[model samples]
Target: MSVQLVANVLIGIALVVFLGYRQATWRYLDPTRIWRTPLIMAIVGVVVLAQTTTTITTTDVVFLGIEALITVGVGLTMGSITRFRTVATPDSKGRTIQSRTGLLGAALWIVLIAVRVGLDVVGGHLGAHLLTSTGTILLVLALNRAARAVVIDQRIPRDDREARGMMVR
Candidate 1:
């Protein structure tokens, strides 16, 4: 394997471990916390893509498009399945929404990873080199996380008293 490929694999493993743990735990659904990760990943992905020299091909584009769609779809499904509850906290004006992925959401993450790997294998044979690149992987992951965050954010209770209290109890 090339150095880049090895590095990508190591990074992928690290992400799987870290995100897997984080997803299983309950976390405050603050906008900054929810959005920061994907945004940073996207910027880094763009930078990496810019620095790397690779020939662009229609096959690569098509594969990436399919991967992105699946990523977003899985993310949406995960978000919908996530457990959200409002809890009384010292911060956030008395209560705030907290989210936990639990087992089902984690399963979806595995499914997403499996689907990506399967695509990578198929795309590799078809000359879609970009699909498995470090930069492309990061971009796809960011897209997935962003989509999940969108659904979670939408599910959060509004500022209104009734809505905010809906999840409490």
Candidate 2:
């Protein structure tokens, strides 16, 4: 791979780790913000779909369909890991707040990135494209974020939802 490609991959890995940290430490944000992630994911999916429409074939269609299902399952699984790993403790004010260093969130990012890179390497040598499409990536992200948002939101008590940054049991 080119130096630039390597650099990009490293940067992407860093970005994922950072985002996972944010997710792990996420406290109760605005309820309206709940839609932001899904909306962004949808927009990204649309843009990716639009760019690839011309190249899509029947085989690609089937592959994309299968990929979407797999992404959802994997996304939820990872989200659950993040949820289970996230540490919630009460602040001095007696409201729950997630810990800053989310080891589980970092693990989630590492696992996903490793799987993607591993599959890409194997598939590339086999002359097949796996997880190589924008649709595939965007869908995975959207599903993960949406599912996490739902899972986390549901866990927060209704009163805490309105509170600034407290995580309620």
Candidate 3:
């Protein structure tokens, strides 16, 4: 009913979807751990909903739309990342690019954030708030990328000299 309630619900749904994808796609994820995702989502949703006021603007709607597009792009990118192949036989190439998916995904996310912030600026907000919000988005993206990189790297084991046909001695 309220704008804050809507935003919180949307964000909560997004978190649940993200967690479901992680659980289904990652072999390491435990089935028991899956419940934690929605629980966390609910907790976050309540907190956010409690803090937010009900007012919203046209720009806010546009921002949410852009974010939805970004979410879809990221999901596709994750699927692509999981399907990439890096080996043309262990003996052939020294090393290969595991996946360009993460980079592509990150780029798409950055573009979405940039467009949203740019629109905010163009729409109004000609003050410190605009710059602060933009900077915050960039920082969040950077941290997200870092976290994703760590997870992905852990999922795929790297072939060392011994594994790739070089003698250890």
- Candidate achieving the largest TM-score: 1
Worst 10 residues of 3 by lDDT: 160-169
What TM-score goes with each of the models? 0.87, 0.61, 0.35
Show how many residue pairs clash in every candidate, following the order shown. Answer: 0, 0, 0
Candidate 2 vs. true structure, TM-score? 0.61
lDDT of candidate model 1 versus the reference: 0.81
Model 3's lDDT to the true fold?
A: 0.41
lDDT of 3 by residue, 1-169 (tens): 6564365346435633553444243233222222343344445445543554544555655554554455445544543454334445433433442333434454554454565456546544632222223223333333333344334434444443222211122
Q: Give me the runs in candidate 3 sitting further than 4 Å from their true place.
A: 1-46, 84-100, 123-169
**Clash count, predicted structure 3:** 0
Candidate 1 deviant stretches above 4 angstroms: 89-95, 159-169
Judge candidate 1 at residue 16 and give its lDDT. 82
- lDDT by residue for model 2 (1-169), tens: 6564475466566668667767567553443455476668678767865675444455545545654565566556544554322236655655553422256666666676666666556554555442465545666667766765655555443445343322334
| Candidate 1 local Cα displacement, residue 138, angstroms | 0.6
